[model samples]
Target: MPSQPPDSSKPKPRYTLDEGAPGAFEGETVTRRKFMTGGAMAIGGVATAAFGLPALGFALGPQFEDGTPDRWQDMGPEGEFSVSTYVPKVMNLVADAGEAGKHTVYIRKFDPKRDSKRNADLPYVAISNRCAHLGCPVRYIQASKRFVCPCHGGVYEFEGKVAGGPPVRPLDRFYTRVRGGRVEVGERFSLNSELRRFSVRDPSNHLDGPWQYLYPSRPST
Candidate 1:
């Protein structure tokens, strides 16, 4: 019977990264220059995101040069307006200025120069829905054939000229036209010259002029 003796001649293998280039594992930390470069890149990226892009947009994009907003896009076409029915709309005079500068105008089907007869010849005319007296909204009353302002009981005819009440003048009008089967209204402006001259001057002070704004000199209620 023969017994085999134990053999322990092989040395233990050192752990190494597979397929790595020589001297790649000489140091655990990255180079200082590389670390500084990475830090600088991160800071620069943050700075660019935080401030640079917005400043660039302010410089290159649309700037408010004269503090006045741009002209608003038109609400096109006046032909689509229905006859004798007052349709409410918002007219933008300036872009991006919001609702304050814009006006609430009403367009109805009627002839421009015709008087307020039920059987008038033309179709519709546009009028400012804002009450001439206190800048209140006016509603169309078919039964009375007039636009009635719920506030202070101002009344306007179909032509938007004032019929009665605290309103000193007619409702404001828009620059309106017909185009391509639609009724288009341009940016809001002051009332037509004739209406301004003869209409109620001021709702707040009706006796003075047709153009005065009501509540301007009135005592606080």
Candidate 2:
């Protein structure tokens, strides 16, 4: 093969104006369009992080936060509750909310004969009227001995275990204690299908099976 002589070629312009870029200012290295695009992207990223980080914190922060409530609320004297049946009592759940905090709680004397052994340590069985399915108020029917949700027809047995409908686990319960001569309700706790107690969870959160692994309990629970 025969050797060819070297050829000279023009290099790409360093400045946008020198390269005839549209709307490019004199001596500009980057075009206005490129600058705007980069700025827009940076702004968008910041905006996304502003919204996204809080939401992520709201979702995951509970897992790290320490301290669980040791507060107790006295509902009534010990003489009122009976081992045979549940009694409806108005309780102030939200502190400092006055009348607005009033929520109906079902309380009964713990019965060793019929009640499960796992929860017999509780002096009284205090159950929340909030439905395990969607937090609709449930009314206990004396005739049927069942708690029935009017909104979703979620039914729970006398022991607060899910009997029917969309409830994921047993109805939530609170720790009970005898303070002086009155009955007191302590921090709320959730239960598994087998009536095993766990930390309080929001409605529709399950405590058993694969759902337990998927949605583990948070520290603030």
Candidate 3:
């Protein structure tokens, strides 16, 4: 018998856009490209958070917290310092571990004839060796009765008042107390322009002085 004609009613093989199209999803629901992109975005977010959190904490953590308070440190007998002279003394600060750190300060016992004698409580002045201009160590010139910065030409009188050169303000004054014939020093406080002028006989009174706008009236803690 002759073979019958092939059946024309048979359904043709169906072809869908999902089957062989480029960028098509595997299961018609979630595409491989979309899954990979989402995973990458999640990882990137996690990495950003890991680095950003610590930096944010470091900046804002101590804004409201009360920091450590400064305490008095002894600097030997009050008699050791003489009138109209700068006595260099080394002091150690409290540290976390091991030995404390050493720092130097200039102490001046004002002459009895000076106005500083009017206040018996403030008979002497203690100034930090650090220069106001660039934090350089200032040396005392006994002959000139001034402290001079070797790095710069910053000159300060015996009262720690800036007399000339690059220093913006006077040397920082340490809070001093004479207890049991021993001199004790404490936290440092910056002097305002008015107080700085009080210590000098002929202060630079110009509003547009060299260091007029260099530093703030009060130093930040």
- In terms of lDDT, the best-performing candidate is 2
How well does model 2 score by local distance difference test? Answer: 0.84
Stretches off by above 4 angstroms in model 1 are 1-79, 99-102, 110-124, 189-221
Task: Rate residue 42 of model 2 by lDDT.
Answer: 100
Q: Which stretches in model 3 have alpha-carbon errors above 4 Å?
A: 1-70, 93-100, 115-120, 196-221
Q: Which digits, one per residue and each the tens of the lDDT, describe model 3 over residues 182-221?
A: 9888766555444432111112222134333332232222
The sequence of per-residue lDDT tens digits that candidate 1 reaches over residues 121-147 is 223355667676777778877778789
Residue 51, model 2, lDDT: 95
Model 3, residue 77: displacement in angstroms? 1.1
Give per-residue CA lDDT, model 2, range 1-221, as digits (tens).
98875444767789998878888888899987888999999999999999988767755653464424488888899999998889998877777889977788899999999999999889899999989898899998989999999988899999999999998888888889998999999777788898987667778898786565445454443
- TM-score (C-alpha, index-matched) for candidate 3: 0.54
User: Which order, best to worst by lDDT?
Assistant: 2, 3, 1
